[model samples]
Target: MGRRYDRLIGSLVGTCAAFAASPAAAATAGAPHLDGAEMGLIWVVPFVAILLSIALFPLFAPEFWHHHFGKVAAACAAAFLVPFLVVHGVSLTIYEVVHVSLLEYLPFIILLLALFTVAGGIRLRGSIIGTPAVNTGFLLFGTLLASWTGTTGAAMLLIRPVIRANEWRRYKVHTIVFFIFLVANIGGSLTPLGDPPLFLGFLKGVSFFWPTQHMFLPMVVAATVLLAVYFAIDSTLFRREAPRPSDEASEETFGIDGKINILLLAGIVGAVLLSGIWKPGIAFDIYHVQLELQGLVRDVLLLLITFLSWKLTSRENREANGFSWFPIIEVGKLFAGIFLTIIPAIAILKAGTGGALGSVVSLVTNDAGEPVDTMYFWLTGLLSSFLDNAPTYLVFFNTAGGDPAALMGPFASTLLAISAGAVFMGANTYIGNAPNFMVKAIAEERGIAMPSFFGYMLWSVGILIPIFVLITFLFFH
Candidate 1:
């Protein structure tokens, strides 16, 4: 009789334990599908836009047909294409958490301010270096400079000079492709501010110093390889253009008269600092209010800065440089298609997390059967070359968190993969990096014929991919 009663009590406790565990496992299960849904939208929107733009761009601007349309148009098409599809397809969960509110939009505004400041700074100096021998120098210097001034600043400062130097050359496409690889992509590996992924890591628990210190060797190696490779390719192209009579006259000095634009730029930076220091309080009820206030002030200041930069700069300088709103306008025209198309894909990623992903995501095991964190940085880096590096970084960034024990692994090694992958792989295609589009637009505005979308990838897949694999093996593994 006593044994029977004890068995009844044991069964009751087991039932209660099962009930408690069920809710947690259930919550974890629902997360992955939701993630997939969210990411799926990113892909869908851009694809639709690609179809629409093929019809729309020519209809709207028939004159665009007469000059080289394939380069800029294909690039713009990609700016709308790759990021939208890849982000939509990844099934990341972060967006799901912030989906209901405007806080998710905060980063976009920050990017806008940051990008504008970068653009404004570019407008000031234009390009300082000319090419062939100096082209590789610009690439190396720009990569180092990216760590401090931001990749956008480095890209903007160097692009014009590179373009001008190669302006007389027929084979300018290789120059821009290498520029995207080094200046736009691998250059940002050192700092959080340098790349969005490291910045996101900063917002999480990772230290700023950690990534920079660990990444230095790889950065130096990659920069050196890229410079050597760029010089070789550039030399070959240079010889081809050289046999023909040089139509281009070298400019002695190109000077800027608009110094006040610098002050306006300082104001934009000040606005960002102000917002950071005076973050709004977030109560459950009023969470978005703070984000709204900060965003409004940030954007308003950007508007003022844009106006002042335009107003203070001399008209002759603008025309002499052939400066127009075309670059910005081009960026604006193309990203709308990207933004609209990727929304649904992100939804799918959010909806499908954990439920469908468990089989696909697992640890690498040693011969002894000890589990290790999978080498995600490799594939994530590769995918980033095709997708928008930011969302690609986020999806894998979250995925790397599975076993708490994994954090005990080398911080430098792990974050190196994540940071390096995101920054470096951005050069995989023209659209992989934000500055790639801006640089391409700037080049085309100056009348250089850049490559088509696939053409740019051919350069990357052929040259950059092998270098990245060497990097991963030498350092990351």
Candidate 2:
């Protein structure tokens, strides 16, 4: 764990790096700056409780959770807000709320909504045989498609097609499991729109293509290996399974419905890219939070694009695709709590050794005080595997140094570690990423006896972990 330390310190010297920032210099730089150093660990309890509730409630109380999850989220959010308002005053509370909501949560959910809406409308209408090669092709194509369509969108779009192809086979659990690993999680690494955590990075000032540039190699490496492995396993399973009966074979030609949504998806991409590249320089203040014209335009355009896609597509297309609003609604409600509760966690991590999460700093740093890339990878990843990855990513991003310029420069590797960890390790569990559970639920609905929570981990633990180790050696190490 001992590093030369100079590299880390050098990284810190750049543009207010997060963890490396001097206690005086960093201190969570922002308006009405929250002094994380002054806040006790108790302040973090709500964040922890909310994440735990997300992880636990569905397992223990599916009925109550299904009906009342939104209320639970609001209660957890109030757990922090009520206390903060009382202690910090209405003005500061309002600023924090407005800042986070306007800058982070709103853009995030909007982007997800646009992608989900657009991709949901486009339905694959034809049938294809699920040979080993065809199955591998589905996975690889979804992996490629995920960066443009959000993981949720990509997974939702292709999963049914993949399942339909494989339904004739008796043994295809491995195919679905690998589908979760690649299409739902790892595939989203290449672009901000691909994953929530990366989008948070983009919102924080990481360029739209920063991930594409820096993350491409690692993504390609992991994807190549996983795809190769999937091909081998799938081929073996295909051999073992009995041949499809003549009646079960696909007689339908492959086609797609709602093809116009493809253009709309492009529109969504253009809107997001415009927000990043076009700085109109005009801005407005909303309760101490600065809102830019470009961002405003981007959001409005996204909403318009969502409207156009929904209006243009037939209800029949979405119904055939088995599209439902529940997944996105669940994400919106749950992440509302996540984004709110994570405020202090980000602040504390930004405060470094001076904050409640000081030990976190120690764990990811060497004795010489350099950031350890490997530890960052594992910790961020393992945490993301269990807790929600987006917040797990934000915590580590601030911990490294919240400054985008510095992180993109000297601490680039650290940011890469955090990014890869959050996106990749999300495949480790059903709850790790939003799409994981959705994909699992969909598979079960299709009559696949998907692994139980722990049962699924057997696939992840046996396959994904070793791949992660190779990734560490290839990049993070």
Please write out the lDDT profile of model 1 over residues 155-195, one tens digit for every residue: 76567767766665677777787787777767877765566
- Expressed as tens digits, the lDDT of each residue in 160-197 for candidate 2 is 99999988999888899999899988999888888888
Could you tell me how far off, in angstroms, the CA of residue 5 lies in candidate 2 after the best superposition? Answer: 44
Q: Candidate 1: where are CA atoms >4 Å away?
A: 1-101, 124-131, 147-153, 202-211, 236-252, 260-353, 363-374, 402-412, 437-451
Runs with alpha carbons beyond 4 Å of true place in candidate 2: 1-30
Residue pairs clashing, model 2: 17-401, 18-401, 19-400
Cα TM-score per model = 0.64, 0.93
Per-candidate alpha-carbon RMSD to the true structure: 14.8, 7.4
